[model samples]
Target chain A: MHILIIGAAGMVGRKLTAKLLTTGHLGGTPIQRMDLVDVIPPHEPQSEIDIHCEAADLSTPHTAPALIARRPDVIFHLAAIVSGEAEADFDKGYRINLDGTRALFEAIRHTQSYCPRVVFASSIAVVGAPLPYPIPDDFHCTPLTSYGTQKAICELLLADYTRRGILDGVGLRLPTICIRPGAPNKAASGFFSGILREPLVGKDAVLPVPDTIRHWHASPRSAVGFMLHAASMDTAAIGPRRNLSMPGVSATVAEQIEALRRIAGDTAVKLIRRVPDPAITAMCEGWAPGFEASRARALGFRAESDFTQIIKAHIEDELEGVQ
Target chain B: MHILIIGAAGMVGRKLTAKLLTTGHLGGTPIQRMDLVDVIPPHEPQSEIDIHCEAADLSTPHTAPALIARRPDVIFHLAAIVSGEAEADFDKGYRINLDGTRALFEAIRHTQSYCPRVVFASSIAVVGAPLPYPIPDDFHCTPLTSYGTQKAICELLLADYTRRGILDGVGLRLPTICIRPGAPNKAASGFFSGILREPLVGKDAVLPVPDTIRHWHASPRSAVGFMLHAASMDTAAIGPRRNLSMPGVSATVAEQIEALRRIAGDTAVKLIRRVPDPAITAMCEGWAPGFEASRARALGFRAESDFTQIIKAHIEDELEGVQ
Candidate 1:
């Protein structure tokens, strides 16, 4: 099977690449050739499969047509500007997220007599404030951010293109990846992972919002699993509604702290500092607290049931199980 | 107030123009100037207000900017390729429906210190089959047609732009305009108007779907009222969710025929021929039957409560009070 992975330089992209390489096959088909693309060149891993890594900006006019020339059997589109940046730069956000995605879809349509499976990484950001406690799978998307708007628009395009038989597409609206294996960043939602990731590693982390603040989450491993399943699963079941809200564990900030304490001892819990920033607090109120992702669950996608398993996954995958 | 009508040649646009000229004011403000634009030059009307008619295509790069240069106080964006044509030509549909709308939004954003109320014409096509009998305001859009997909995308852009303070915008998901005053067209939804219109005019009309087939509708005058209300209403009440399903009468084809018979007698009803086209029947099955437009109702947008009122409005407006 020939495969193409866009945004391969990002964290989830890198991890997904590692998992695919370890298996050396997908859906029982041997990986003969794979192309990894991003704005920056992706790391070349040691593998028996024929692999090529290239740096390409998809928003550029000619880039999409050039990428589709090889006609990969399966395409994973994960490239996008993060929420904060997209909100800050409107023109740049639409150019990369919206125009770039359309260019890729159009290129595939222009190809003669070729149909490939396209797995898109959508986000829960598609829905915004006044959301239900357990937002149902069929709830409307009234996104408040430019980033979410871009994702929602792309989801519509994905379904329309699939309906027209130009491509077979599936969009997975991934929850916030918790216990993210990296240094804490300044993103508004960073605290969700920081309070857990830093304390587990015997370092201090700031908690910007109240312990009562709840949100949906999944481990980095589970996210990659969703991507693989989306790429290989029977798409006929998806029908015209190609986008889906993925199943994940819903936990409050306090619950996340307790999970860290259970796994890494009392010292980890003490490392968390409660220095609330009202700006971030107000922002958190608008984030999706949870989702009733029953459709994805019934379709064979799975995730951790609680925060404990999520932390354990992070420990095993990122920390070599030292904790 | 200076107003711009993007689709001044369309039936709704022309009616709206006539209504504005008759009233000579909007939202308690005196009318000063008006600009009418379409793909072809709109018919010039005899009016006391300064009126300019021009031919323009919004999808062209410079067209939107040139139009925005004048900075009309209220802009009615009613231009689009109809559903049948959009489905037949993919490239043309996206270019005009999606790209054209985006271009206009961008133009308004680029204008310095300029913010105008933009009333966009969306459609019930945004939502498709498997719909609840009374589709709620929060129901997700899963459009089955290319035209619906484009409208849904534009609705997203309208909300995003409004939230960013780029422009004050309102998108009305207009129901099918019944008794549309025009020549019989090949549009699949044409039968909804044809059965009532041709019969009232002492002519024969064909009904392609079963009498039990239900759909949402409003008269042309009601549609014009919706545009006016959207343009003049206090948008602060709309919050971030700028798109709304406008209120309309929901009736089955049998109900419509009964209303026709009460007004035009058995002879007019006899003109109705039922010859079911399986293809059209399948298509109509995916159309929206009803909507719970509670939000638009609360915002003071009103429509006919029954099919009889719809037919009466058509007779009074289109037929000059002739029965």
Candidate 2:
């Protein structure tokens, strides 16, 4: 079966591509061909299967229809402007995130003959301030930021398009990924990973918020698992509410530090400097600490039970278990 | 203050126009001018204020910016394709409901000088099936219908635009309006008003579902009141959650009929005819039976307390108190 991966140049997309290459199959169907797309041409992965890589902006009018013409069996839509960038550039956010996503859906609808399983990467940022601890699946999306609003709008469109039989779609409101394996990115939630990732690698990291600041997280490996499951799951079980909040380990900054101390000793913990930036702190305040994720969990999606497991995944996958 | 109503020909828009004309002022500012826009030119209200009536489709290019060029102090965006029509005509729903609203917002943002209070008429359809009784203000919007999806998308945009300081926006999720003072339209929820309205006016009304089927409702008078309150309220008190579920009476079909019995006795009630329609009954089951509306009420937007009051409102306003 042919498969398509949008945003294939990003961290999750690259990892997912690697995972698919290793598995050699998805939903028990032998992978015969794959198409990967992004704003910049994604590095071609070494796979026996036919892999086509294209650098195209889906926001442009003809790009989406051109991509859909390939008719991949499963489409993983993981592309997005990160939280900080979207919040900073208003028109860019709407153009890339909202209108771009709608264009893709419309393209699929025009296909008229095929209904592909489309898995969308939504975000916990969709929920705004004054959050309840372990927020329920049904909590309203009052996005505090432009990026979150775009994600929320896409979720609505995803559900609607799926309901209309234009495409079989599922949306995963992924928690903030922990131990993100990369250099520091310009995301406000970067500290959630930087404090841990930097310390383990013998580098000092800044803690922008208080140690009491808690958040939900899952490993990069788990996120790939979510996409695969969403692609294969019996959608009838999901009913009309196609979007689900994936389960994740909820941990405070102090708890994250403690986990680091247990694994990499006090020297690693000492690398975390308590230098508060009020701007980051204020943005962190609106983010959720945890989620019920009852619907997602009930549907059989799983994640690391704790931050320690998350760190372990990064060590094994990114660090080659040399820590 | 100059005022603009986008859907001036509709019931709530007409009522709000008349209400503004009656008051002669809004937020203690004298009414200097009014612009009424719709698909067809709205009938000129008998008022001394300078009125500009335009028949324009907001979805078309240049229409929204043209409207914004008028520089109304407050803009009531009450235009939308109702549920049944949106479900049947997918393209029309997205073009008119989603794109049109965004165009108006973009026009305002481009102006960059003025920020007008934008009051949007959203619907309870934003909340989908398997609902909890008295759904809270923050319940996630999983719209089951295309109309609902479009409304939910607009609500997200409304909040985002407000946050970016493009416009001072407030979205009201109105309940099924009871005792509508016009001919039956194609709305799936039309029967909610039809059953009460036709029977009271000494005409036979069809009941599509069993009396046990309950739904949320507000009278036309109450709906007008909510818009007025939203136009005048200090948005700071609303915080970041711009979309609110307006307060209304929660009653079963039996309760509505009983209220009619109380107001106009058995004669009015006897005009009601029970004709089970499985299609409508199936549709009604997915609708919200009630809402908590705690936030809207706290912000001083009031509605009729019970179905009895709703019936009285229709009689006093539509029937000239003769019923």
Off by over 4 Å in 1: none
Report per-prediction Cα RMSD to one decimal: 0.9, 1.1
Write model 2 residue lDDT over A84-179, tens digit each, in one string: 889889989999999889999999999969999999999998999899998998988998989999999999999999999999999999989888
Candidate 2, B1-323: lDDT as tens digits: 89999999998999999999999999898999999999978999888999999999999999999999888899999998888888999999999999999999999999968999999999999999899998988788999989999999999999999999999999999998887889987667788898888888788988889999989999999999999999999999998899999999999999998988888889988888888999989989988999999999999999999999998889899989987
- Error in Å for residue B135 of model 1: 0.5
State every prediction's TM-score relative to the real structure.
0.99, 0.99
Model number with the top DockQ: 1
lDDT of 2 at B98: 97
Per residue, candidate 1 scores C-alpha lDDT tens digits across A111-194 of 999999999999999998999999998899999899999999999999999999999999999999997888888888988999
Range of the 10 consecutive residues with the lowest summed lDDT in candidate 1 chain B: B179-188
Among the numbered candidates, top lDDT falls to 1
Clashing pairs in 1: none
Docking class of 1: high
Residue A191: error of model 2 in Å? Answer: 2.0
